[model samples]
Target: METRFLKWAEILDFLILIGSSVTLVAWIFGVPLFYHADGPVLSIFTSISLLVIVSLRLATRHFQLWPFTANLAFLMIVGGGNISSILMLLSAPAVHINPKSTLVMTSISTSIGLIFFSFYEILLYLRRTPNRFWILDDILIHLALVPGGLSLIGHIFQNPNYLSMSIDPRVGISLLEMAFMALLALSTVLSNPNLFLWKFLKSGTANQLIFVGLFVNQYIAPIIYLVLMHDDWKSGDFGPELFIFFGGVIATLGFLLFQAKLEENNSLIRSGIN
Candidate 1:
């Protein structure tokens, strides 16, 4: 029964992705939103990128085409592509998608990626499904993201200033990334799931190397961009929402990790006593 429900939930997620792609394509066709003025390609590529991620997920259920790295690559493509989009909106003279629309894209894309990530863990990795913990991800998607995403889609169609907005105000959320894999992939996989990567990476040094690389690329690189190099910072604009979002996520993740560790230690104690 639990497996049955997950299937339906996955289908709904796919449908939402499809609907969003269709809407985004239509909007771009009507009013092209380019990543660069000299190069008008990214607008179209966004939809293509979305399709590719979905297709990859469908094609590899058994970890056939490389289990660990595949999804990370997909996320890199998605995150790397969309990360700069917020900055485009924050730049002066307002040359990118409207702040309202940008906010929508941020919420939708992040929410979708997180939903997929959580589902992958719940359905494939976790031993228990449909637990009380599942409600956390559900709240993120249903309560906050879905409504905002729907509103953005509706607003894009009606606004005359569709791709135009004032970047004159120095206030906009900087995009921030948090990669648990970089921080604790080893801990997560080696927990109750007892999962591990291919044998080649199971060795101590190799895993450490990968962890360091991912930490630098996924966590450190983005922090540098958001803080020092981003246009928003250069323009003296800063929105506290993204910081709040980042903070809440990190705090929750920390608490969860602590709980998992405590549980594991308690289990070992029980086993020893028996």
Candidate 2:
């Protein structure tokens, strides 16, 4: 029953992305949703990010491609955690979104997907389907990503001030760079999972080189550019800043540790030695 629900959740989450067709269109227009930069540099960088993400999607059928899938999902999940839009639908006045109108539309859809995907991954880990849920690897990922995503769901959806929060462009871009680093670390750690995709990836040296290069270029490089040019190197009280940025890391680690304890107890029961 849990497994079935998880599968449905993944389907529904993907459907949300599909519903946000505008994002895909904007992606094609060389306009990456989160980055609000203009000019040729942004155009080229977003184009490459699109190229890599699309490639990851294409390879999903035959290979696990968790790196790509997870990153894509993360993009959708974090694009815009704006609460004002939902609040507006509930009769509250609409609030401004930092991203442009077109981008905001897509980001809203992505933001909504967090609730479903986070639950799906949790069920996947708990269900422990053969090698599909390796304790060491899956734990690390869920620890880093799941809790962070879910914890912020409330802030994005319920807090009216969330969308209105002021952030230094440089800070936002730097935070994004840190996100890319977490993703890269995830990809490296789970590189050799026991799966069919591993065999395919291991066939030649070219695959590794291409995958790593695209990983950096498609995801990391753009953020580097964004932060470099993004200005406002200022400091302030920054109250909610902790929740906005590093919340995911703290949540991930805490939840995974607790879940690990539960899984250990469940394993003992399954083995019937106790």
Best by lDDT: 1
User: What is candidate 1's TM-score against the reference?
Assistant: 0.39
Candidate lDDT values, in order: 0.38, 0.36
For model 2, state the Cα shift of residue 137 in Å.
4.7
lDDT of 1 by residue, 1-274 (tens): 4355445534544653464466467655565332322211223333444455544544454357556556656666655565455455445324444433422333223334444443444344323323332334323322223222222222323211211223321121111111111111222233212222222134479655754454234233334444554445322233342354345444444444454455556667888953
What TM-score would each prediction reach against the true structure? 0.39, 0.31
Output the lDDT of residue 115, model 2: 27
User: How many clashes (backbone N, Cα, C below 3 Å) per candidate?
Assistant: 0, 2
Tens digits of per-residue lDDT, candidate 2, 1-274, equal: 4355444534433433342344456557766545543211112222233233323333453477456446445444332222433344234223433334333221222223232333333343344323322345444433334332322332333322222223212112122322432343343234324322233246579756754553334333323433563453212223333343444344433443454566566667898957
Clashing pairs in 1: none
After the best TM-score superposition of candidate 2, give how far the Cα of residue 112 lies from its true spot, in angstroms.
20
Q: Report lDDT (Cα) of residue 156, candidate 2.
A: 33
The number of clashing residue pairs in model 2 is 2
Per-residue lDDT, model 2, residue 187, is 38
